[model samples]
Target chain A: GAGVSQTPSNKVTEKGKYVELRCDPISGHTALYWYRQSLGQGPEFLIYFQGTGAADDSGLPNDRFFAVRPEGSVSTLKIQRTERGDSAVYLCASSLMPNSPLHFGNGTRLTVT
Target chain B: GESVGLHLPTLSVQEGDNSIINCAYSNSASDYFIWYKQESGKGPQFIIDIRSNMDKRQGQRVTVLLNKTVKHLSLQIAATQPGDSAVYFCAEKGLDGATNKLIFGTGTLLAVQP
Candidate 1:
């Protein structure tokens, strides 16, 4: 794709339900990242993937949050037992390298009721 | 516990005037800085970037100045336009034990007046 793409622009899930957000990165890019932006706040890093392997998951708030990049191009973020606090905009970005400029997707706005 | 912060939460500028947005980072290990512009309900777009090795970088009408001595970063937009009105965010990348991580600061809302 020309830019990073995220699916399901908006999602409203019930509390304690599972939700999954998807991200399709630019072609030929090897680095992908997930960040969450809360109201009135900057984006917070969640996880970063280098190819198919997760290089860093330390930023994940808890064990309930998980992400995967099966073939190193498309990634999915899964949240189990979602809470109301999970409501936020989840942004996906991809870069040619670790230090390269990041291209971001419009993001998936998740509103957990 | 990286605290990247903006000096001002909002900036209003006249169209065709030069606008400056300031940011500060507490982590001295940060070696890279980037400026991003985000419109309402949209993703952040890359504006410009500067490496710590250099003090200044310019791209089109955008200029980024980095002051390692004071750990400050500034973005100057020349001939600001109405389309330039957006939320500006500054991000820092550190090279200590933390790598491949960019910490973003609270953005500044830039409003351009005619």
Candidate 2:
């Protein structure tokens, strides 16, 4: 695809269950970012990957939320023991450089029941 | 912690009219500011950006203004269209290189009415 892509446009899970959201950034892009947006609000930063390594993960809410860009091209966000408060639209973005404009995917909407 | 806020939660404007959305940030050290438009069920799309060295920047039909003294930002759309209706967010990029984070404001819902 020419743009960033995200899997499972919508995910419905039960509390205490686990879920993984995937993001495929644009080819050759070195910077990838993850953010979470609640209803009627802006996205809050989650984490960012410079390549295969995570340069920043401080925005992650807790230990239950983790993300990895193992191959430096595809990234996965893992959530353990999902809670109702975890429901939101998980967005993925990629940029040529950290300061460059970001290209975003449609996002994966997760609903915890 | 840094916080950004919008002056108005919503704004309704007639099609073909100009629309302006305002935002305020509390951080004085922020050097990069960006405006993003998010449609329903879609991720935020970058509209425009301005650095601390520049006060104004224009892109296509949109213009972004930055005022460092007051820590204010504004996004102006030349001609409002129904397709342009969406939530606009103002974000300030943290100067810290290690984090690579941008703090976003709540947002302003722009309604373009025909």
Candidate 3:
């Protein structure tokens, strides 16, 4: 793909339901990032991956939020027992390397009812 | 926890005027900064970036100024257009021990009226 791509541009789920968001980064890019953006706010870092392993997961809000990059390209963010506060736009970005300019996707808007 | 913050929550400018967005970061160890523009129903797009060593950098119709003394960063857009109306964000990447995370500020909404 020309840029990072995220699946299911919009998702509506009930509270306490499990939801999974997928991201496919640009080919050959080694770094991927996940962020959460609330209404009227900027994107907040959730996690970062350097290749197939997560380099930083400190930004994950709690145990309910988790992300994985299995092959260093496609990634998935899973939220368990979603709360109303979890309703936000989930963004995915990729860069050639850490500290490089990130290419972002349109993002998946997840609404927890 | 450390964070980046914007001085203003909203900015309104007339078309063809220049717009300036300001941000203040508390982490001195941060070495890289980037400005992003986000439109409604879309993700943030990269605008410009500046490193800590440099005080200023310019791009197409956009310029970023960094003042390490005050830990302030500003993005100046020349000839603002109505199409430029969007939310602007400032992100900082720290050089501190093994943390390559980019921390983003609250964001400033820019509204350019015709």
lDDT of each: 0.92, 0.91, 0.92
Write model 3 residue lDDT over A25-102, tens digit each, in one string.
999999999999887777899999999999999999999999999888999999999999999899999999887899
Put down candidate 1 lDDT per residue, B9-53, tens digits, no spaces: 889999999999999876898998999999989999999999889
Candidate 3: residue pairs that collide: none
Cα error, candidate 3, residue A100 (Å) = 0.6
Candidate 3, superposed: residue stretches over 4 Å from native: B1-8
How does residue B55 of candidate 2 score in lDDT?
A: 95
The TM-scores that each candidate's chain B achieves against the reference are 0.89, 0.90, 0.90
Q: Residue B58 in candidate 2 has what lDDT?
A: 94
Q: What lDDT score is found at residue A81 in candidate 1?
A: 100
Please provide, for model 3 over B1-114, each residue's C-alpha lDDT reduced to its tens digit, 9 standing for 90 to 100. 422333448899999999999999878888899999999998899999999999999999999999999999999999999999999999998766488788899888999999
Error of 1 at A108 (Å): 0.4
> For all the candidates, what are their Cα RMSDs to the real structure?
3.7, 3.7, 3.7
Superposed Cα deviation of residue B79, candidate 2 (Å):
1.9
**Fraction of native Cα contacts kept in each candidate?**
0.59, 0.65, 0.65
